[model samples]
Target: MNSRAPLNTAPPGMAEGLPVRFADVSWDSMRHDIEYVLVAPQRTRQPLLVFLHEGLGSVTMWKDFPYALCEAAGCRGLVLSRWGYGQSSPRPGHEKWPVDFMHRQARDFLPAFFEAIGHDTRADPPWLYGHSDGGSIALLHAAACPGRVGGLIVAAPHLFVEPVTLASIQQARDGYVTTDLRSKLARYHADPDSAFWGWNDVWLNPEFKHWNIQALLSAIRCPVLAVQGHDDEYGSMAQIDGIAQEVPQAELLKLDDCGHSPHRDQPARLIEASVAFMRRHRT
Candidate 1:
């Protein structure tokens, strides 16, 4: 793993008045670091909101949503890319993502990341706002470290791999090799294969169908607001519904005529629901 590309080079921007800093958290399996941007709130010492990107997402992929949401809620935000995505360290070309990638992200990567950023997990628990795969990661993390997170807002998360998901991922595999997906992904990832196969190969594997964490939902003790769109192409409401059924204090928000990317498809509703959830879970 290369040690340099994933490291932060500068702040996000000055226009938002929220100070953004680049960060690097070391990992044992690889010598590289996972990179992230920290956005401090304008006037508060509230719990940090950690933004986790989608399967095909990166730090820049989240664009300005973190900043806007953080500003609206008057809280700091930390947006990070997993090892294979964004400006984070590139994985080896032959590296295969473990079936427990989401688990590793939640239990291992996030804790190291928060500590590296100088936030005390015991004193300043972060709120997780995860989308797609990131949402699964947030749920798994919150379940594993219930006391480390203040709240959760998950959008289009997956608890179990559905047949439809496998079929779609198989299609993506074909597209990555035979279509223009590679070139398109290159625009966001420094090494597109690292990002693509890291997510794709794992989801498409034959043995991954039973990789369900729905039972883990009950372990999440924090306030949770699970949101999903009526027309999400990647997942169904079963994702959030699973949370509501198991997590005693979970809230549900369903959006109409929306797609997988609610933050992009239904920005206003997403913001409103998210702001309300954050306020409701204020610690």
Candidate 2:
């Protein structure tokens, strides 16, 4: 375990007045350090809520949402920039991610990350809150290790690849080149190209079209709250609808006039719903 250090006291960010501590998690398979930060670390007795960012999202990209939600729910928060995103180690230039990248994250990286962070899921399983790609990851984790999850809250998660999602990713690729997407992403990621292309290329890969995790949803035994924007551009209602279908007890919330990101598009509503869900499922 790497020594914890106080993060720079930057105003109006995720940590804020809390003790924002960084951990260097050794990802044995990938041989890299995964950067993670804990909010309200002193409140260890409170339920743990792990926040997962989107494909283009990093610790910084999430801004104050994690902190806000954590406060409302009165829980500890764990926000981490996945490998190849944010200040964490970038993807190796020679390596290419497979279609099962999200699966790998859920089954492999998350467990290692939890161990490195000294979180014993078996003794105290944490609730998972994820957005977009992160949402999908949260579901995968819950499915794979239901015993280690207290509950699940996902926003705009993808259970399967959709034509609309492919189109949006393609548009993003064009925007990355034709517009200032790269520059904007640079504010959050150390190597924006690694983050961009790693996500973009895999989604656009023809073989990836068949990627799906619908079958795995049945394994998730914990309580679930799946939310999506009514106007989500990346995916259709079928995403959350599919969750409801598989996880029959899964709660669904469709926000009006919202987009792919419920945390950004309708945070207050999301937070309220999330707090209620966590409280209801609190063991």
Candidate 3:
């Protein structure tokens, strides 16, 4: 991780804007136009922090949290919208994402995405900060890729499907159809159906009920910080506790009075812990 290439240096006076851009990448046997932005690229020598969004999230949905974290941690941040989210390419028709969709993104799509966007996975590995589904993807990436990424911090991640998660997702499915959820999602995704239905259909599928990664966590060889809110609707404390059991170097942060989104419900605390964690493993 010693190489300091200005692969994505921000344009002059563009730090405040965090403008969205696109990159054509070949991943999972297909070409995808990824939506992304670089935060504080002026700090070329600093470590790279990559933000992986949630199931229904996009680059815009992240708002200014990446900027705040990068500023506090003294690192550069790379935020991207995975295929089917934001202004990136939409999911093909109404097909559902495979049960191993996260696997594909972590083991295949992510590396290719980084390469297409000029982030050298070997020369300058990134520290992943993932939330919800993004968090699960982070765990899969860290486990499968081993040393490709520097380290990771996952918030409200699910290593397996839980009853509560499925119920909530079912509720979300109903909301998407009955309420204004689609209208709200339209603000962030180019095709809200691509993000919502793809994620929903897979999670609600019968085959996904037993999708578990507990066995793979041991393969992760990098520092890991697993954060979860006490009241997280998507998962219980067992998620992070399960991670700690497998990865000896893993640390856990359980926040009180918070929900599924720690960055939103507890930004100050999350940022402080994140800054400290990055500093401790700055090597």
Best by TM-score: 2
- Which residue ranges in model 3 land beyond 4 Å of their true spot? 1-15
Model 2 pairs in collision:
none
Off by over 4 Å in 2: 10-12, 18-21
lDDT (10s digit) by residue, model 3, range 8-27: 44323235666667888887
Instruction: Give TM-scores for every candidate, taking all chains together and pairing residue i with residue i.
Output: 0.91, 0.96, 0.94
Q: State the local distance difference test value for candidate 3.
A: 0.88
Q: Cα deviation of 63 in candidate 3 (Å)?
A: 1.2
lDDT of 2 by residue, 156-201 (tens): 9999999999999999999999999899999888899989999998
Cα lDDT tens digits, model 1, 105-215, are 889888877776677878878889999999999999999997888999999999998776787778888988898999988877888889988899888877788799999
Q: What is the lDDT of candidate 1?
A: 0.81
Ranking, TM-score, top scorer first: 2, 3, 1
Candidate numbers, best lDDT first, in rank order: 2, 3, 1
TM-score: model 3 vs. ground truth: 0.94
On lDDT, the stronger of 1 and 3 is 3
**Superposed model 1: Cα runs more than 4 Å off:** 1-22, 41-44
